[model samples]
Target chain A: MEILMVVVVGVMFTIATYMVLTKSLLRVILGTVLYSHGAHLLILTMGGLGTGAAPLLSTEGPHSDPLPQALVLTAIVISFGVTAFLLVLAYRTYKQHKTDDLDQLRGSSDE
Target chain B: MSNLLILPIILPMLVGTILIFFAKNHSLQRVIAGITAVLLLILAFYLAHEVYYHPQQTMILELGNWSPPFGIVLVADMFATLMVILSSIVGMLCLFFAFKTIETERAKHYFYPFYFFLLTGVNGAFLTGDLFNLFVFFEVMLLSSYVLIVNGGTNYQLRESFKYVVINMIASAFFLVGLAYIYAVTGTLNMADLAEKVGVLEQQGVLNVIAIVFLFVFGAKGALFPLYFWLPNSYYGPPAAVSALFGGLLTKVGIYAIIRTFTLIFTHNTGFTHDIILALAGLTMFFGVLGAVSQFDFKRILSYHIISQVGYMVMGLGIYTQLALAGAIYYIAHHIIVKAALFLFAGATEKITGETSLYKMGGLLRSHPLLGWLFFISAMSLAGIPPLSGFFSKFALILSGIQEERYVIVVVSLLVGLLTLFSMMKIFMYAFWGEQKIPTEKVDKKETMGLLKPIIPLVILTIALGLSAEPIFQFSLGVADQIMDPSNYIDSVLNQD
Candidate 1:
């Protein structure tokens, strides 16, 4: 089960990285979102698959690692905020620049 | 008491919140902002003294008095205190420079809050012992920076700030994901606890993978090599004071994170992780200087040099020795002050000649003697000229590199230094020493307009730091020693009752 999860996450990360490297601004934003999801999954899988109960100690059985779960909760919130900000920035850039192909926005020397 | 740690975080935030209402009143905002900065500077100095004299101490604020793994803790160490002091120093100088430069009323109102929040994020990042909290502080800094970068809403600013915002947002997301994974594995958010937990995972490969993931996250923030493209452009959009502060403090915050993590948490895989860092440092220095050499704009050149200078600090980390890390810390201090001074000098030149591009200006030395001489001193110091703080830092770095028998990296560092000197001289010649040309409307009369005030204190600081290098180097060496031995930092937080 852990190996399957790792392979799935690895494939997702490659696709996400490829999307980010593209010239379209919107794709790049989506790519970032995808990449982050893959990374989160990879972190989870690396911790080793666990069974029994939730990390709460009140449960009498063996528990999952509560630390990674706590970390993931924070990570999810921060990433959500950043993604929302990036979406606004993307829309703003598109409205202003009138084109999303990053190549058109060349170095200063081009000016 | 631990509550003192909250003062640095809360005071600026409260003042920043209050200043937002009085945006229309520039003079009032200025007075209030000025006083707030002075207070912060004093507080930073006091904190520094406390950290220095009291080694066994830490101001660990337990959020809601929750114990250990459950709560967020802000831990103040020698490094965090030092960063706070330097940031306030930069903050005070930038605000003073802004007094004459910031003309727009809206800018005055919003600028102070963003500035304070930026510092808050910086101080918060330095102080936080929890990995997730570090990400939060980084977000706080980045969000404020986004607003500041596009503050004037210039067409150019809007265009550039968008890319800057997007790139940084992506980096922040990765940071979160990285934290999530680390937490999933370790089951604790506290940095000290994670350090203890990371060791229990005997699988070295998994550890190596996590360390590399962290490198990408911090690397994007620090502008290390391939991840550095966003920096030069975004930095160019903001006004001179904003640019200087960004140039000085923002990336250093990222580097500080890298130092904290690699030293405390990832020390187990030094051979794998540190080796990659060493190679990247060499490439970063080489390519960064090359980028500087090609840039024609005064500010653009300086922007590229920030990347190159960061390599020096990273080299210290890659070497992973006491003296080398000391040199890296010293170099960071020297570079921040000197780099900020150079950027301010660029602003001063733009004020006089009304030009940021080197092609339009000539023979500044003939009229603005102070500006020319000051720029020269900063340029020289940046190039690692002897007796200056820059030289001592580089001296220790290269010597330590050679001691470790990393001959290739040592040679590359020296060559980068020479190239750095060459590019700085290029700036000096094109902008200052060439033939003087009178402008269409008595530009010569306005040559000294608004030049002297900002550059004086900065120039004094550059030279003063050079003249009094011994004690400063000793302190840096002490910080370096502390970082090398993480037990000092780890024990303090963990042992706290």
Candidate 2:
């Protein structure tokens, strides 16, 4: 199960990299969203899968590491806020330049 | 009294939130921010004293009374306190400078709140004991900076800031990936516990890989050689006040994290890890200075120089000796003050001439001699001229480099210093020495003095830090000793009540 989860994370990261490398502004932002999801899943899988027990640390039975869940939750919220902000920024950039294509919106060319 | 450790993070956070309420009342916001800056400075100094004077020389505050390796902690060691103090000084001056210069529109857009929240993030990152907490603080800092950078909402700012945010977000995702791996390897997110465990863990290959991942995550932030593509353009988009703060304090936070993690947690594989850092440091300095030399704009040159100076700070860490680390600490202090002041000078020059390109302005020495001379002093200090803070810091770094017998980096650093001086002199000759470009009527002495008012203290500090390098170096050496021995930080953290 853990190996499958790791394979899923690999695919997510691969898709994220491809999306981020594209020229469109929206794809890049979505790519980052996907990238963060991949990271969150990796953190969870690396923490080990649940083994027929709850995640409570005080319990005696086999249990998941509660820490990664907490970490992923924090990471998810942060990435959510960041994704929202990035979308708004992209919108503003698009409005000003009249293009969602990042190449057309090239900023401050190196002299 | 250890609870006082939380003040640096919480105070600015609280004040920043309150400042949000007075978005339109600019004067009230400035007054509140001014008092907060002063108070933060005082608090930082008091905490520095407390940390240095503490018996074990580390003030540990376990949050919610949860002991370390189990819950979060805030450790105020000597190095962290020094960073807090230096940042407060820069923040106070930059905030005050923003008071006079930040446009009313920008101020109305919650600039004060963003500034303080940025400080909150910076201070929190410095003090937090948990690896995951560092990521959270980094986000807090990045989010505030994103808002601050786009405050003016120029088409250019929007365009530049989008890439900045995107790149940082991607980097942040990887930062979490690194965190996850470290947790998987050690089963602890607390830095102290990680330090203890990593030292004993015989899994050298995975540990080295994890260390490199962190270096990459932090290297991007610190504006190292290849990862610094986002810096120059993004920094150029902001107003001088924001860029000055970012130029001075923001990149240093990344360097601080690199130094802390490398020194404390990732000590087992120095041969593999530190060598890569040293090589990167040399290339970072060489290429960074070359970029500065090619730039004709005032702020652009300053921005490029920021990357190169970062190399020197990392070089100290890469050398990894008591003297070398002490020099790195001293170099960080000097670079923070000097770099911030140089950026302010760029801002002040723009205020007078209404131009940023070097070719467009000239004869500023004839028009405003004080500004010219002061900028000259800062430029010289930046180029590592004698009897200034920059020179002494470089002196210590080079001295230690030669001692370490790392001759290639030593040569690269010396060559970089020469180029730094040349580029600085180019700025002086083109902008201040030639014919007067700005009409005399346009040069407002009163306003220029207002801008320079906040910067003069930094100039005084660099000179003071230079003249009194002995005692200061001694203090930083004490810092180096405290940090170099991970046991000192680890035990005070994990074994604390």
lDDT of 2 by residue, B1-497 (tens): 27899999999999999998999999999999999999999999999999888999899888997788898999899999999999999999998889889988999989999999999999999999899999999999999999999998998899889999999998999999999888888999999999989988953988899999999999999999789888999999889999999999999999999999999999888888999999999989998999999999999999999999999999998999999899899989999999899899989888888888998899999988998999998889989998988888888889999998999999999999999999999999999998987776665788888989999999999889989989998998999998889898898987755
Model 2 ranges with Cα > 4 A deviation: A57-60, A108-111
Most DockQ-accurate candidate:
2
lDDT string, candidate 2, A1-111, tens digits = 989999999999999999999999999998999999999999998887777467666777776567888999999999999889899889888998899888788754553
After best superposition, candidate 1 residue A4: deviation in angstroms? 6.4
Per-residue CA lDDT of candidate 1, range B269-308, in tens?
Answer: 7888899999989988888999999988899999999999
lDDT of 2: 0.92
iRMSD, per candidate, in listed order: 2.9, 0.6
Deviation from native of the Cα of residue B88 in model 2, angstroms: 0.2
Which window of 10 residues has the lowest lDDT sum in candidate 2 chain A? A102-111
Among incorrect, acceptable, medium and high, the docking class of model 2 is high
What residue pairs clash in candidate 2, if any at all?
none
